[model samples]
Target: MSTLTTPHRPSGAAPHRPYRPSGLTWTVLRLHRTALYVWGAALLAAVAALIWLLAAGPDARAIVGGCDASEPFPIDCGTAHWTTTARIHASGLALVSACVTFQIYAVAVWAGAALTGRELESGTARLAWTQSVTPARWLATRLAVPAVLLTAGTTLAVLLLNWTRRAGRGDLSGGWFTMNVFISSGPVAVGYALAGLALGALAGLVLRRALPAAAAALAAAYVLHEVLDGFRMSLWPAETVTGRAALQLPHGTLVLEHGAVTGAGERLSNNMACVGTDSAAALERCVERTGLTDFWTTYQPESHFWPLQLVESGLLLAVTGLAAAAAFALLRRQHS
Candidate 1:
């Protein structure tokens, strides 16, 4: 009786909001939550490792004297250099470095196998399409969710890595030019992750089979990684230091090429015969005979680090945009 007289509501009254994803978007998220969980766990672990390294870094430096000496001769600083603390810190760094290096491949594989390929192969995507979600929307949802998650996670990881590397400083961290250090310590890491996601989605859509898609994604990601790594140093013009007297490069300079130059400023390749000289006097004779007026060194000083990082990251993000565009176009054509 009371229900029969149900209370009147205003025409413009707002409906009760439920906490859940709706439609195909919800379906996509629900299906991929496991992968999301794994990603979160891995990120948390990396953060923990970085924090541990930060705390233990000083002890590691103390054991190894921070390797700060600028002597011309190598010092045999002994077994203390390899103390347990140092080893642990090194291991932590290695683990973090590995995560940054391999994250692209991992993203590609997961995107191919779990996000797109598996859904298409299993007919779930088709089923969703039948239920009012257009193919374009389906694909967009697939890419968007992962893109948001990958961006956040990768950005956080990179910032944490930069902090950790700064914390360790001195000899405990890799040089700025080192591949892993360079990639992990800046925005390029996020770009790589997004590119991997886009490429993997494309691979999955093209292959439509989980295993093959995963393999293709991995191969594509590796090729991209290699290409970027090779091109990194060339992203910015290097500065050259020329001196008639032997000079020590400023610390932390990323030397690109160092060899003899003529007074006319012509660059010369390294002469093997000259390089083979073991004695300083022999080297001097070789330099004199070669018409070398000065030793010229081309290098990227530490100041170039940010410029290089920004350039590389911009290129990678462009690649990501292309891959995403291609995937969307392909999906639209298939549906049309």
Candidate 2:
């Protein structure tokens, strides 16, 4: 009975190997560890900022107002909105920038490097292709693990931001809000980060190398960010991200473009209206004298909340999702 139970196995039978990562996976894990500190720091800053904003009163803006531009780092975020280049810092405000940058340099860049990039670089991918795991699974596991965890971290950051901003406002205004484009600011970041990873891999597919792939992907994504602010700016008629009918200004109305201008009662400029002089008073006096050809309204950040948040987030997410889908398909089809 014992003999029957313990039938001799052929030498070719699978060996009783102890648990061990495939050499490729080990390389991936080793590389990913470098990103931990980056991810940790971004999340930590977000949490701390949220805590500070809640504890500190609204007047805390006063302290940060005077901060000089030695480098936006260690920026006192309390008065960040009041500063001139306010929007520039918004990306960094809720831990979004730190996490996004970390993801870009680490996960996004390294994934491209390790997946097809490293293999193609060392001339080892051909060797790896002949191993036990198929190239697709190899790529999938390596990309998926860190990506899933990263997405979670990003989502948390977004939530913290939303909480803090609401606390700062002391109430939730429900119209078109700018800050809400990122509900937590962190989610879109994570979304973009993942999109970056997928893009890096796709770049690997396209270039069949790592360094170039990573660089191409990161550069492409960044340039898109730069262009995005101006994306529908000239293209879309008015307020591509938000909509509430351009308010009627005193002389004309503030069009999306060309603020406080000479002749625009009928013509609506997009974001600006250029009046002859600086002062709203001076502009009004000119309008009274000239019999009001165009209206001139200055920029007013939306005071309304929920409506604005919904629209901006929706449009951004839609655009991001489309970009991501394309990147995902590109990654999936790399070996296909």
Candidate 3:
């Protein structure tokens, strides 16, 4: 009675804290921390390279005579042009494009092999379900964590790519509609990433074996990529420029179709005979004989860049949603 006694706590009992519901999310993140680190490092590298390219842009343009000057000039100009061109082709634009493309494929493989398939194959997914986590919540956590990280990484890369491309655009060799350029330069990068994630998850759930799932996911991703590439130009209605004389397409225009058109607007195959000759009179005669009233060129202008990007992005996002929904539905069916 005379001594003050401290309350004894149970050895097995831990300190009480406010309820926090991020355990599953935290677990997913911790398990994949290595991947996160690699992704972060790659992203940082890409960003640094992009910034360097941006900074070097003015010099590159000056070397190339500011995008408007004729080629084959002074020795210094030639050296500068060659150096800039080599750098861009080898490490600048090409590097960024490869990085983004690799990310999409890597995400698909990881999602299938490490994220969902392995867990299910090892029976840990079942064990987690026993620990009061529903299959839905478990799968949600799995997909959501990677999805968030992928979106952020992809978005940053895309923004950096856009900056780099815009800065060095005048000196760059490719058009905006170039497949690699288009994919890396806009929100479609993020969309592709998301689609990869969803496709991978679906592959994982379906196969439940890491290696097979990874392969399946990779194949699905490639098919999606090819489909998107084929349909991209059709996303927006192209503008047509027609002239009685051979019309000169603007620099950087993405020509979808170019052929001879009669005055009544009948499109015909291009007259190859008129090509590769310096004589304008021969071209004129060819056009006259072909009854070509005008040379019509269907093209996506530089101005249509945003519209095409948005449309492709939207379609990709929609595909992501469908794949995600399918995965969830399959999970529910299997678990229930």
**Best-fitting candidate, measured by TM-score?**
3
RMSD to the hidden true structure, all candidates: 6.1, 9.4, 5.3
Superior by lDDT: candidate 2 or candidate 3: 3
- How does residue 126 of candidate 2 score in lDDT? 57
User: Model 2 TM-score?
Assistant: 0.57
lDDT of 2 by residue, 180-297 (tens): 3423343445655665666666666677777787787677666654554344223323332211122333332223444323444454444333343556666567657755455433
lDDT score for residue 167 of model 3: 61
lDDT per residue, candidate 1, 112-172, as tens digits?
Answer: 8878899899999999889888888889989998888888887888887777777765345
- Taking all chains together, each candidate's TM-score versus the true structure is 0.81, 0.57, 0.82
Native RMSD of candidate 1 (Å): 6.1
Q: Write the per-residue lDDT of candidate 3 for residues 1-336, one digit (tens) a residue.
A: 599887898999998799865699889978888988998898888888877777776565564454324646667666666776666644677868877866678989989998899999999899999999999999999988888888888888888777776666533636778788788888989899999999999999999999999999999999999988998999999887666323566667876776776768776865432433346686678767767666766778899999999999999899999999999999999977
lDDT (C-alpha) at residue 59 in model 1: 74
